[model samples]
Target: MDAPTNIQVEVSLGRKKTALLRSLKMPLTLSFPPSPPPTVRDVKRAIQKAFPKFYADRQKLSLPEAPKSLSDDSVLLFDAAGKVELVVGDLGPQISWRTVFIVEYAGPLLIHPLLYHLPTAFYRTEVQHSALQKSIYAMVLVHFIKRELETVFVHRFSHSTMPLFNIFKNSGHYWVLSGLLLAVDAYRPGYSQPVVAGTWRDGPLLQLGWAIWAYAELSNLIVHLNLRSLRPAGTTTRTVPVGYGFSAPFNLSFPNYFFETLAWGAVFLISASPAAALFIAVSFGQMLIWAQKKHRAYKKEFGDKYPRNRKAIVPYII
Candidate 1:
């Protein structure tokens, strides 16, 4: 079979000011035929075809003045026009999504336990510890460990490579928040009290929180397993996930995100730090945005076959 004729593209590799190709005595500007109205991936492929040393997986293509790297690989080259001002560079190094998640989750799992048990020089005085604090710590550890395990065994990433810069960003987010939550709860004055001290009135709220957390964690796991089952090993085929086991019977949207939010809500109920609650709010907001996007994409793909009454991340309310 004859190969498809490639479209001509003029690509500038590496940043305008600091071109990596130029440093390596390679051409900064190269003209290659990719495809008509080439996507970012096409440009990368073109570069790799010409210069096999420059791997597409490590490249981070973006506009010169853009605040962040371009995430949309399907964007047409011609549509960029003046906006192109193409600034290409290595995103340090590429890493798999599984590695990223495992590493990110591991930071919190290890750091939290150390901070709780071992007193630092700054926090030399031991605050009165409570059963609730120990419970919360255990829950946090379990949550992150489960996440790491899921990344390894269950979750399937659509894209294999992530920008190396994301490792730092994600690590900072999880690490800082974990440290802050643990430190604030442990060392902060008047913050180490039990959420419910087995009192007749408020003790039930603590029990309810535990129940909700358990349910949410279990439901989230089931949803992940269902999603993983959709794409069998050695295949890229996508199938609509039917509601089953912990999923709402009539809903075809992101039920996992709903359960995830509920789990965090339960965590917030048990937490003494306002920061923890704030973090949950922010995480839920971000999850909702992604869930809504997923919902819309499903509707677009499935048309009338998609469920009509299901909300994005919530059952009846979004």
Candidate 2:
């Protein structure tokens, strides 16, 4: 039998209506091509076309019975009568993931330099920071600047947007720990200074730490580029990252996380600040959880094709 040319979709608002607008009293009737099997995104686009005021990003489309909003890629299900019902929830204010990432990274990028230069802001007095303190401060600036650049040019998110309020939560995390906390600790009086006062002998060790930090930062960027390469432009395809990117001698499920932790660890080594250590510990815990989730997702998606030897967030260890 030939495929149906069009499927009529009945669209209405969900129970949890947005306060931004009153509930859409009249259900909308929209026609979609059946050959392509329209997705939630297509349905939302159709709705947007009909009601120009309702943009796709602010619309959360779902099935009539399902309380959860449908993903943009979800295929529409039509009954035998060639009719499908859809409910849209208003997301109210929404922000693109790209904007969220930029905002989140910008917090640290801006705060770090300010706290470092304004000694009185954090230290409460005019006090000289050790040479190592100055070096680590520079590293902090470089690291966040690189992150901002990557967020703008390199990274592609699977989801285009998120709720508006998440920007504050994410920004606070980076701004507080990695930026304000570490910078204050590093710039504090006498940090990284030798008790014996013998010409600040950590110069040699600081040089070594800087080298390691550079390597880790570069490796992290490579991993991000590799991950980006796995998914082509304008698509959200997940493929097994083999060889240098996600597999091989590293055998770490999330080498990016490992390299990021290593970079932060190098900062701690350079500054010898408790705040830096605390940041590393807290971030490692979070990265480990995310790595474990990603590892599980890989195994679940690829099954036996996934290497059993791969460990999450760590090399050769859990």
Candidate 3:
């Protein structure tokens, strides 16, 4: 089959019509020819070529009618053009991915604790506290705090800037879910019952749940640290992560996600809240999707060197 020819594209930068026409001597319209249709990145490059003053990475190309900026670098120009009018602008401000993660996690860590102290209409009386309830609070707090710390100290993000709106979206997701899980578990009438109440609060089961939670949390931290050590600071390098200790046999593509699910599953088991279990299921589902994407990416990037035996998020099931 014959290869596809490049499609011609005309791009305009910035919003001020009068200012752009008056201040700029060069022609605003520029044509781009890219094989298989150009991406947003190609459009930005064309803009940069026509007008040397504009930075490609800093530019936000969009359809004028759209409410949000066109941020996807991989989107074909032809696909976007059919949807709306193409327009380009300078991205006003940017924040790092690490900062976004920290902020998102911090919201839940801070807001979840307030449910216990704050006078909310949800509880007719002050929510009665128990040793188990207090333990749950401590674990939840530590979980988020650990994530925040890891984002700052351990995780190295390749893409520096995320969509500015994502910070708010992500923060809202974590904050709302954390509150929902904690509130449901803490204030529910069943939680107020003593440990002597049947098999639900059996001593051995509670101990087992705690053990699973601790192991998963610690294992996840180790996996993250090991992954971090693979790539040195101030560099972008890909390395195959070799499992060690408890992780040695699995050869899972994303053991971190697996451990994360286990940690939340442990919490769900301990809390015995259907809502909490549902949240864990939703989270695991999302993580599985991402893990599969990562697995494909690794295969594409490393080819034969990448472990073919590795499953996405599970040892053998997935």
Best by lDDT: 2
TM-score versus the correct structure, for each prediction: 0.73, 0.89, 0.72
Expressed as tens digits, the lDDT of each residue in 1-318 for candidate 1 is 443344334446554444546654443444434344457776677667776766787666776566466753556454323223466676546788778888888887777777677644446756555556666777788888889889988988777779777898878767776555655564442444453355432466667878999998998898899989898775546666676532455263788888877887777776645767766777788888898898888889888877677777877776
Which residues of candidate 1, in runs, are more than 4 Å off? 1-18, 21-50, 59-93, 120-122, 186-202, 245-252
Preferred candidate (TM-score higher): 2 or 3: 2
Predicted structure 3: lDDT: 0.70
Among residues 3 or more apart in sequence or in different chains, the pairs in candidate 3 whose N, CA or C atoms overlap within 3 Å are none
lDDT of 2: 0.81
lDDT of 1 at 101: 84
Q: Which pairs of residues collide in model 2? A: none
**Pick by TM-score: 1 or 3, better one:** 1
Order of models, best lDDT first: 2, 3, 1
Give the root-mean-square deviation of each candidate in angstroms.
6.0, 2.6, 8.2
Clashes of each: 1, 0, 0
User: Cα lDDT of all candidates, in order?
Assistant: 0.68, 0.81, 0.70
Off by over 4 Å in 3: 1-57, 60-93, 118-122, 193-199, 245-247
Best candidate according to TM-score: 2
